[model samples]
Target: MKTLLMITGAALALAANPATAQDRSNDRAGDIQFKVLGTAVLPDGEIEQVNVDIVGLPANTQTAASDNYVPTIAVEYFVTHNFSVETIAGITQHDVDAVSGLPGAELVSDAQLIPATVTAKLHFDLGDSIKPYVGAGPTYFLWVSDKPGAATIPLGVTDTDLSDEFGVALQAGVDVALGDDGFGLTLDAKRYFIGTTARWFAGDVLAIETEHNIDPWVLSAGVSYRF
Candidate 1:
């Protein structure tokens, strides 16, 4: 077959060149972008409570949360070509289980949530390599460090207090380009209506209290760089 006709004549000589007929990897007007991600803390099972008293506890005691895989970073600035403003630095880890048909006594806890976000983006031109976006803001959830299980709760607790969350963030994204330099590949999705309020201690005496409403759904992808 003559080597498949010399690979079909080099794909018709690179499709007849001419800068590939437009598609310069879009994003104009003072651009500055960077992204590196791999995260998913999806939890939309509806968690809520504002207060609770513990003393042999048993009054609506229920808690179960698990899902973690983190390592993310984002930065985007394009204040013109359709407006942009993005900032997100992340950290997520959660695993709390204490629900035994009732009467809280099978405790197991862990948490590490450090999130900071400020977004305001709306970009769309759908041409030169595709780029679509939509965003919303305010996400501050930092109540890092917490672990208290006391050997699966035999009473005589130690310490645990995790509370600090101020949320409201919505987003949608797209950006694909792997050619004309400037590198790219991004696909994001976020929805955090946050929640946190939990306390447990025995050394200083303040047994337990609860209020958690972590409505989360944060999915992400990686690789993107443009200047």
Candidate 2:
């Protein structure tokens, strides 16, 4: 009879603890965070092709070399503690010069492009300080300017029609947390695979077609805040 009475008293005591009950409720609130990042383009790529077909210039005498160094900004939102969505925007500038081996002919041209992208990311925590992640998505390119000189061909033989481009991205990064106050420092790397079609024209005359594949590397460091 005494054993039964003691068991009843212990059960009543366990049922009266309010702290344990409140902890379960707080666990369902989830974790949401925001981050801002800055990135720079790393020099990475080989010249694929350069085609020029204009009057008064040798058809096979034109070529181009790849350019690097681009800057970008990104804003990210965490849907949960381990998942996030981000949007990135940036601009890139390039300069190409044509050399004619046929005596004295020199030509130089410059171009620029701005691209905006949206991506989804997944995060993994390694402990209290380190978090590594990966991301992928799509992008749209806006052709800003295309300026060329007349020494290689003619003054009016400039191509400025580079249509919109489409591509995908891949990324990986690590975050180092600052204390327990939802603050951290982050370092990351990303690759974007983008391609576009370029059309050359002499006033109203269609000259040549060139396909451009731009694959650029990005390295970044930033800070993050969580709630």
Q: Pick by lDDT: which candidate is best?
A: 1
C-alpha lDDT score of every prediction, in listed order: 0.70, 0.60
Q: After superposition, how far is residue 76 of candidate 2 from its true place, in Å?
A: 1.0
TM-score of each: 0.32, 0.68
Report clash pairs, candidate 1: none
Off by over 4 Å in 2: 1-38, 42-52, 55-71, 97-110, 149-155
Which digits, one per residue and each the tens of the lDDT, describe model 2 over residues 37-134? 66666433222455654554454444442455544556677665555787866677655444333323323345667767787776654565676666
lDDT of 1 at 208: 74
Clash tally for model 1: 0
Clashes (backbone N, CA, C under 3 Å), per candidate, total: 0, 0
RMSD of 2: 14.6
Residue-wise C-alpha lDDT for candidate 1, range 1-227, written one tens digit per residue: 23423433443353346443234454376888899989888764223663545666555557666778888989989876666799988877776665543534334466777878888766554566776576678988886787776443466668877778788877777888788887899998877777777777778887776777677778899999978
